[model samples]
Target: MDEALLRSLTPSVLAVLVRRGADFAAAEDAVQEALVEAVRHWPDDPPRDAKGWLVTVAWRKFIDTTRADAARRRREDRVEEEPPPGPASSVDDTLQLYFLCAHPSLTPSSAVALTLRAVGGLTTRQIAEAYLVPEATMAQRISRAKRTVSGVRLDRPGDVATVLRVLYLVFNEGYSGDVDLAAEAIRLTRQLAAAIDHPEVAGLLALMLLHHARRAARTAPDGSLVPLAEQDRSRWDTKAIAEGIGILQKALARDRLGEFQAQAAIAALHADAPTAGETDWAQIVEWYDELAGLVDSPVVLLNRAVAIGEAHGPRAGLAALAELDDSLPRHTAVAAYLHEREGDLTKAAALYAEAAHKATNLPERDHLTRQAARLNAKRRA
Candidate 1:
């Protein structure tokens, strides 16, 4: 009856099917069908062993589908001898599932969708709603992803960095519809950290926790974006922040510096601050330097500019920003903030208006529009 429990068991169940010689695509479909049946029946007739129940039902479903398909006739003979229903294997297949779902053959969007569905146990409609896309469009994307990875061998190890990137992408999506993707990403990352002793894995989990701890204060009552410096720190989850800092500290001790660890180091600094004005921007700028060395992303440079503005002065930040491409997303907004910090009200207002026109999301556009209006009003007064 516990939906989260069922979803959590999904990847392992599918892995069992794949291990038993079932193809990935068919095994995934069977697992989904079993999940639907569980939702319909589990509340009224709960099973003694949830994972075993799912494996039995899904394997039968796989066999039935394979037998019906002439193209899969070769698989029908092997699956005809159904494995006896019993307790699920003690061996954890969740890690392999993570690798398989984040396989490099698929596009980023496709990988995210497949990971959510096959590993996260989200339905296609749920994923579509979370992404604010049409169900059919999401369905096609997931289908293509499955086909792309169908030929891939599950026995081989997968790239850890690719898996981390996929998880980070999920975390950055925040929350929408019925899924809190950020929390889901944290859960999966925690699972990954337990399975592997990698510092980057721990680092990513820490970063997610630190960011998620501030979710409550990230928006106003009317769903308006609240700048980090302006957020009410009283609302932040102290426990999560503490845990994040602890995890980050251990990862940092490992000395295997990675992008996520660098980012978490920055987040820990922010959380350590008693107030916005007390933030250690100089240390943060140093961390940004590390992050810049890890990746040459323009967004990272833009963020470093903001840190420079805080650590040095507005003019210094402007100088750093001047080296980046003007067409980058949020560049104008960053420029506007720097100009405002320099007390150039007219330039700030105009830049804010321009940024609002180019904003990608509703909340951001509304926030930028308000900034522009506030500055325009100030100029008139």
Candidate 2:
């Protein structure tokens, strides 16, 4: 069976059930049942029209479920009559589904989980594995999310910013277990971009492509984190970078700048450079300024400190860093880098060790620890 085909068709099939009067939660459950049937039977007897098959099976499943539940008998009248089986309606409610899954009523974690399950066509187990949570925990989260948005009609527009933020959260997850959430996020974003003509959407896609292009070099052979400056540029995916640049240029040309577009511009500038020394830090600092203006986020300012250090001087970067709260995540690491650039190895080494102790993940902690060790060894020599 072509697992990809089933996943790709899941949203459309579920949408058909909802458009036919099924509630969001029940329709999604039925679609999942249909998928299981397909996986079990498709290998021996594949249908000529995969989508039409899924729609039929899923609709039947929905009808069966609605009739069987005593409390949902009232809903049976709405779905009693089934549409004649034929080619599935080309009217794509996938976009509407995207908006619903990303509805503002849901928390960020709930939205991300629902998007992966309903929009990204991922199983609760798959999503749970990706996030390192138990399957039952993810199932409850998704169930609650579905109920929260079940009463919501798709007659109006959804907050695109919310949807983008959800997708961004997915991308940041990178990969784990059986799922590469980053790749799944890129796929779902591409689907959204095709359905809508929004600059920010294109900007987000460009950003993901550019960042993904460097995934191969983000880690050393031993799975340690490699800073962008130290990464081997040769390992970067030039094709993805080129595509991202092309998309970003078009989005930027639209003159509707957003935070993602600004971030992509910074990524594009880095991708354009031949080496770390050749990077146009001045342009990057400018982009960071634009990003800061677009989103009042201290994290952006913290990053800007690094760019400021590269563009102006170590002292300037440290000054910018000093303005932010010292309790901010990665604040110590950034200070360490700036101090190292300023030739204060003693302070830098101490800061690196401090940052390592505060690191959230194993790889990052190891990288920071190594930085401190390297500087300490240098001092001894």
lDDT of 2 at 258: 99
Which structure among the candidates has the greatest lDDT? 1
Per-candidate TM equals 0.95, 0.96
Pairs of residues clashing in candidate 2: none
Per-residue lDDT of model 1, residues 56-146, tens digit only = 9999899888888845554436568876543554234778888989999889999999999998999999999999999999999999999
TM-score of 1: 0.95
Model 1 stretches astray by more than 4 angstroms: 70-76, 84-92
Angstrom error of the Cα, residue 220, model 1: value is 0.7
How much lDDT does each candidate structure score?
Answer: 0.93, 0.92
Residue 138, candidate 2: alpha-carbon lDDT: 97
Q: What is the lDDT of candidate 2?
A: 0.92
**Clash numbers, per candidate:** 0, 0
Clashing pairs in 1: none
